[model samples]
Target: MTVNPLVLIAILLTTFTCRAERLFIGILEADSIQSIHYGAAAFSRISDLPLVQEQVQARLAQALLLPAYAGIAASETLKIVQSVDSDAPPAPDNPANVAIIPLTDDGTMIRQAFAAAYARHKSQDAFTLYEAPSDTNRAPCVAVAVADRHLFTSVSRPALTWAWQNRSKFLEAPAQSLPGTFRILVNPQRMADLTGARSAQAARIIDLGRLLRACEALSFSFTLEGAALAVTLRATAKQGSALDALLASWRVPSEPLWHAVPDNAFFMSLGAADRPDLWTPFLGAQRHRLLVPTSGRLPPPAVTGDRLDYVAPTRDGKGLCWVQLLPVKDPAAARAAIRMLADAGCTNAVTFSRLRRRQAGATAIETYTVTLQPPQMAQADKTPADPSLGHILLSLLLKRAVLECAVHNGHCVTVIGPEGAIDEHLPPETFAARPLPLNRRIGGQDPALTPDLSFGGFLCAADLVRHTVTIMPEIKPEQARLLPRGGDGATFGIVHNGRTLTASLRVQSNEIAALQRLNREGRAVLQEVFFQIFANQMMDSKRPAAQ
Candidate 1:
């Protein structure tokens, strides 16, 4: 008997009456896993690097969850149903996951396989249970059962029985055929609610709840052709929701500003804007804090055009610097905004002093120095100021902070760097002299890919690791272990095709290891950074007050 894929999907779409009961359904059509294998095998055969080939094999085997997965025949059709906790956030370490995998041959093959792996077996509550005592005590009592042509596994017997009993609810009469090789649909609102509850302050600060409320469902799909794998993530908007309105208003196409970025730049994010008001969605309220860092409430500069943001290493490759370019619609308004930012600096415990003015080709650049003032101490604790001491402290903290602002070719170009490393990558002339094509750099050049995507960015993985370790030497060893090496880069693009918004991540076959490593270590990297910052703050608090 053959099952209609759409019937299974319809069952997945059904709403549960219990608030705590959550379900996740995944459908893998025939040959899906085989295709992934084929891609990896083709890559391995073509790749010149032997280590990358070995890495692909190891990753594929681990993902399949069996040592001899390479020899296992691909299932004709695979349906996976898991029960999730709606109140709790999803996590990798969640041990409550119950999986129901459809089986072939009356489930006898899988039953025998489980029995061989476990030490005890018995029949209880109309379900055969197999127990595996974990050697490490991570899962002392694991359970597995084979019933109704499906294999169930879970740490909890209650969860297993619940899934077995409600298994019928996830299927119906035959209907339409499945569309993609692999697809998964999730309830975005439920996930959003859990996230909001967990991070109430952060959710409120960014209005994350409201923004995610418009998404009725979030979907992911994957397709592999030859050696290239394309993964797309899309959020289905609710009818008449705030996100619906926002998406409708986002009609501006991101312009091509890849040529503006220097080849040595480690990262780049470029987009286009028709007017200043449209930037709110991309920048949000945090733009002011990032761009100006002033305590004033003055409006942002009136600018509208293509945006080019890039980060590159300093001349000696010891430090990193950033540059931002925005189209200058009104130079006078831009100047006034800068002045307001400078004037508001004093209120924010910082000072902005004009250093000098110089000519860089046809553009006139005005440079400034931003210095962070030391905290004040009580009168009794105050001591005579030592000029050398203050100078050393400032140099160590600010590292010769420099900011250069210029308007060239109808764009407000701002470059911020340390140690006077700002003159090498000046806008217009320098960029024109050495233009870096983004598509060529990342191997993402495709004529079919829309040139006017809503947003696009690139990350040079090797450069990122180098620059990150260079900046924070304390984490060099740990970062080396966490980050992937020997990959060119990865590219991400987002497209809004009138009705739906789709974000895609594309990478070359050689960079597969890097992508996998990044996925595994990305969270660890963030945690390490936060821990370092907290440690530094605690040390500073313990230090004696500067005189």
Candidate 2:
């Protein structure tokens, strides 16, 4: 009896739905396992970006050391899931997570990739041969699984059993919702325990136990949104008074100074007033004690009541600059502080004769220009040292640094850089004509992303790459070609909201193909750079001990 087409379609749909549940149920089972420690699952739709797909395919081929993969066209959708078993004892055979990749073409390419991987292991006396059954249905399926120890005995066996028993599972819907191009979830507590147990001695140095106890979990997701790559990190904090104290110490009032930054700056960071006491820990007690003196000819106070801090470096590295804005609570006090700093050799030349005093509304304003002398060469022997040699050459090449300060309207604006660089770029008219203020730029983009206070900065990738290549002429032409050319610079910032802290970084490019290619190849370099930057910031902001 021939079945009606409509009825057949409905039957197929219901069967597929049931099979999908079974697949998801297996995942749930694995997640519930008492010994199971941590796992991550990611799904990617490469078909959306054909160029990216091709690039990934090329990299995978190289990684697998299989030429066949180079010609293979990856499936439109790919999913990878992995888990670890913490309780498993140290042995050759230990259970771990498996990776499931469904392909559109026959499973030949997958088989080749695994075979090549196995051959490499065999050459090193680490290979284990296992005869495994294959699913030879109309659309063949291939599974490549890995374990903490023995791949075939621990991870592959269990994975194959699941695939065989529920053949329809791989053919049905995915096990979970796919949120982004890449996603990761980590159990901080468990990971800490595992790491600490492996190196008990090292744990004493860093105290991982305390940190793990303070953090509940961490989740990270990355996606391509419009012209930018957006990354979001959510960290759950443990409830307690310690967390409260930490959050309270982070709360401070400040304004962003993006408008004051020069257009030629290769990189810049600006943020509102920071507590000088917060930086004492990183500077240490000895340095702190020396910073503030308690005798005649006293040095300026360690904390200058700076309301805003700005730093930038020029593209050619010829100019390094720092700017501090101090709100003048008392005119006499402000003037005394500046004079004290000047007397302590803060500037090479201080000309009180050129000082200008003005008024903005009822507020008093004073502007001063200070010159910093270049380094002097040490006393030469009886025979005068050549001007082309040593410190003499450096001093001759270096221009005298300059510091310009303008105190007005209850605020003091200080800028340090090459002579006249700051004054020429940051004139009153130009500063006032800037289109968007820092706070508005951040809030207007996404209100939810705004934090109590933030430090904003940008770096031009093309300029950075050009400088790097110039310094390292030995870099291969191919590698240099891979670097991104002209594109929108990358922007980064740190935000704090009560107990939570968020860091955001964004890079945009009109050359999407080149940018994606760079991301695929240089992900490790990018990650290392980001980690260093974040770690340095954290160290720099370390709080002082309460007396």
Identify the candidate with maximal lDDT. 1
TM-score of each: 0.65, 0.47
lDDT of each: 0.55, 0.41
lDDT score of model 2?
A: 0.41
Q: Alpha carbon lDDT of residue 462, candidate 2?
A: 52
The per-candidate count of clashes, in order, stands at: 0, 2
Q: Worst ten-residue run, lDDT, model 2?
A: 34-43
RMSD of each: 8.2, 15.0
Candidate 2's C-alpha runs over 4 A off are 1-97, 100-180, 190-213, 224-226, 241-246, 249-258, 272-320, 326-409, 412-414, 419-433, 438-453, 461-486, 510-547
